[model samples]
Target: MADAAFTQGAETADRGRLWVVLYLATTGLVLLLMMLAGLWMRLAQSGWLDTDPALFYQLMTVHGTGMVGIAALGGAAVLWHFLSAHIRLHAWVMGANFWLFLIGVVAILAADFPGRFGGAWTFLYPLPASSQGVWPVWAAALHLGGLLVIGVGFLIWCLELARGIIATYGGLGRGLGWHVLFGGSTKDVPPPTVVAATMVAIVTILALIAGATVLVMSLINLAFPSVELNPLLAKNLIYFFGHTFINATIYMGVIAVYELLPRITGRPWKTTKVFLAGWTLSTTMVLIIFPHHLLMDFAMPVWAMAIGQVFSYVNSFPVLVVTGLGALAILHRSGIRWDLVSTLLLISVFGWMAGVIPAVVDATVAVNSVMHNTLWVPGHFHFYLLLGLLPMIFAFMIHLVRVEDVTPRGGDLAAILYLLFGLTFVTMFLVGGWASVPRRWAEHLPEWQIWDQIAVITAAGVITLTTVFVAMFLARTPAMLAKG
Candidate 1:
């Protein structure tokens, strides 16, 4: 009976690994396409290519929406693989989510390309309706409908994950290590579980509801032209949803680091009282911090804006003090080999930390009033997403594939080039932002063209190096899996 039980568990693990591979492959593909779309927009801005303004915005919409979904999927893949080790999750549920997300992507493409719906990814209320003959009302409805389906899929996944955690660990507090935080027990909770629990708890309630509200309002407005919605209310809900969704990506990435880094370093990153405290604080701050994005809205209450600044300031401490310090300590003189996973994960910590600095600065009311609409906004997020988040996603994938050697051919060069160009590209945006260069412009003035030109070049290099990295992984994956 014991042997049979062990065999059953092994089968479940195999199934989980298979799904993780699928998720990673799909995410990489989507990211590649989205990167190209973003490059096209930048090239147009640099005067290297002539693109119609409408087409430029359509590409922007696709890039923005698609990249967020891809990032979420990459993070979810990491969490799903690690969490499956501790709890039983239905493979079919994850598979359904994947299919729904793909469908939504296709629907978005249809809305943007043929239908010419270019309201941007936020699909902010009234803009979809106010497309001014750029797109039909039905196309707007279809776009929102796709998003609604995606939201429903995400909601269900979070709900199932929440349910599984509760059933396996007794309750949310137990799973989240609240007992340890309160000095009640230092028992069985692991850091990854705390991440999973906190993320699921916050996102299940906040992101899904915020997403549903915006999508529903969009569909209603599309269906009933007479039914108008408050613009301020819609903006608030949409940004709340957007902020929470992206924030959840980082949480999942951090959870992956917690689970995978220890294995590479031959160290045990056990859940501690302080670590649990950070996550608990994160649960509250992440939800409320959305207000920082809306600080430019003079109509928004001063109290909410104040809350945004305060929480944004406080939110930096956990990642910097706890996760960053803990990672440094783990890597310090551990005799850890600088393998692909280790190298990428270590750099990802820096990327995340550096990205947060700019984000925190921009979150300040004074800086935000000037920088919010500038290229600096993209500079910070792209730094975090491209430098911080993508590397973590790749590291997790490499871990799953189990590359036997630390040194894949050309990997060292690829990593160096990727970092060099990615940093340079983002720096250009930051400098441009500092110069008050506007964002979301299809064309740039002569004064801004030099920055865009440098950015386009650096971006191309970054994209090329990323392709090399992906290609290296693909080349190694077959051999690694065969060995297994």
Candidate 2:
């Protein structure tokens, strides 16, 4: 019986590793491909290529949807692998999640490329139905249907995680370490577990909202063309889902930091009441924070917009104050040797913090009134997702492989080039937005073309260096694992 149990454990370990590789590889390839699409659009806007406007919008739709999906998948992989060490996450569930994501991605790609669906990633109501012959009604339906499938998959994954936590840690409140926050003992709960608890709780509610608002509505519209869903309600639902989904990506991606930083820093990241309190605050705030995305909707309630700005301010405080300060204090004068993984992890926190400034500014109704339609929207997200979450994902990928003392040659050069060029690329977007340049345009005025040109050049360098780094990392994985 003991031997059988040991064999079962070994099989689970092997399957977990395989799932990690599958998720990582799929996400990395998709990200690079979408980055290429983004580059093409930017170059076309710079007047270097006379691409058709319809084609540009189609690419935009794919790139936008693909990037968000990939980010969530990559972050889920990181969180799942690490969380498994502390809890009982079934390998088959994760495998199913990956397959579901892949199916949804393929469906979306078909709709965008072959079916020629181009209502932008948001797929706002009326627009999907009113594509003006650019795509068939069925194509738009397929696109939203694909997203619904993915949403169902995500709901399943989150439910499993929640179940695992509940079974292992007694209940949701205990898993979240809320007992300690409410004046109980904090001795047993793990910090990473608290983060996982926070994520699952928040995402579960938001996912339901997404299904009801965006995916279900879209499906209903397709089946009953005269269903007459409220446009304002649909818009609210779309942004709510879109905003929560991407924000969840960053939160999920940052789990790597909470789990791995202690290993690298030779410190214990305790699940103190304060820590739990911060995440608890985040848990409450993230749900209501979608209002910030709707600040520009005049039809939206003033109370909702006010709530958006207030939550935006309060939301930044908990995450930044708790995690940010804790991370810095852990790293400060620790005499720790900084390697690629450690450096990337550290930089990710700073990138996220820096990115929030722009985001908070944009969340304000006054500033959003002026900048919401500009490139600033993309600039803020690109900063956090690109420099912040993506680096954390890369770091976690590196963590998976048990490398020896020897570092790969050119690792530093690759990291430097990727970081430097990537920053310049996102910065140019912010600069252009400051200059009042609009987003999602295939053709830029001569004045705005310069920003597009510079962004393209920097993006090319970033992508090139990233490709080389990924190749090197993959090549070394087998040897590194063999050493174990």
Candidate 3:
């Protein structure tokens, strides 16, 4: 009976592994397509591509929504793949979320393309309903409905993870090592993966709830023009949901660094009290920091904005400092061999840390007054997502397909190229932000076109390298799956 139970668990792990590979493949394909859309926008801004203004916004809508959605899905894959080792998770939950996610993607694409709904990804309250004649009511409803579908899928995913963690660890607090941190009990302290997963599950569940509330109310408002929501309330909910959801992706993706880095360096990433405290601090602060996104709105409560500003400074440090120092300490005397995975993982640490500087800068009320509407916003997020989160996801993919004595051809070159051009690309956005170039504009002035043009060229390089990475993953996926 014990042997049979072991066999069953192995089979379950194999099935989960297969689904994770599929999730990564989907994520790679979508990421490549989104990069193309972003490149096209840059080209249009540089006057190299003749895109219709409507199409540009449409592409912007799809690109933003698609990238965020795929990031969450990919992050879930990373979280589940590693967390499963510590706790039993249902493979069917992963499969169910995948199908639901695909369904949501289809609905969103149809709404953006044929339906012509382009109010931007935020879909901000009345904007979806107030598109004039650019799009019909059905388009707006479909778009909102699609988002609702996606949120539902992710909600289930987070819940399943939470359920697993709670069942295994006795409670979410214990999963986060709170007992070890506070109660001073050393027994059964959860690893970094569980602590991270616990944090993600708590925050993501809250984010999705906030997201669903606003989405449903907006859909109702759309269906009945008289049923209205306060614009400020809507903005708060939207940004809260949006900011938390996106930030949670980084937390989820960082698990790869935590789990894989020590393995590569022949070091153990133990969950000390410091690590637990760092995550605990971040888990609270990340939920409260979204108000920084609304700093420009005078209608928001002064206390909320203050919380946003203060916590923005505080939130940027805790987990990052702990993780950064942890990585360095582990690698210091480990004599680890530098490969594509290790290189990218280390770079992700730097990118995540560096990205926070600009984000915190913008989160300041005074600086946000000037830079909030500029390209600085995108620069800050793209810095982390492109350079930080993508590398983590990419490293995990390569790790999955990696074999002993078989080096991936040109893998290191592709990673280097990605980093170089990604830096240049995001730097162009920062430069443009310093020049006060407004973001989400379909066109740019002559002086602004230079930065856009440079960004266009750099974006092409980033996209090309990303394609190479994705192709490498795709080629090896079959073998990886078969081995599973």
The TM-score leader among the candidates is: 3
TM-score of each: 0.96, 0.96, 0.99
The lDDT for every candidate, in the order shown, is 0.82, 0.81, 0.92
* Cα misplacement distance, residue 294 of candidate 3 (Å): 0.7
lDDT of 3 at 229: 94
Clashing pairs in 3: none
lDDT of 3 by residue, 392-483 (tens): 99999888888763555565767777899999999999999998899999999988999999999999999888887788789988887677
Error of 3 at 273 (Å): 0.8
* Candidate 1: regions farther than 4 A off: 1-8, 479-484
Task: Give the per-residue Cα lDDT of candidate 3 at 250.
Answer: 97
The count of backbone overlaps in candidate 2 is 0
Error of 2 at 340 (Å): 1.2
After superposing candidate 3 on the true structure, give the runs of residues whose Cα lies further than 4 Å from its correct spot.
Answer: none
lDDT of 2 by residue, 6-98 (tens): 889778877887888778877778888999999999889999988999999999999998898899889888878777777767888888888
Q: Score candidate 2 by lDDT.
A: 0.81
Model 3 global lDDT (CA atoms, 0 to 1): 0.92
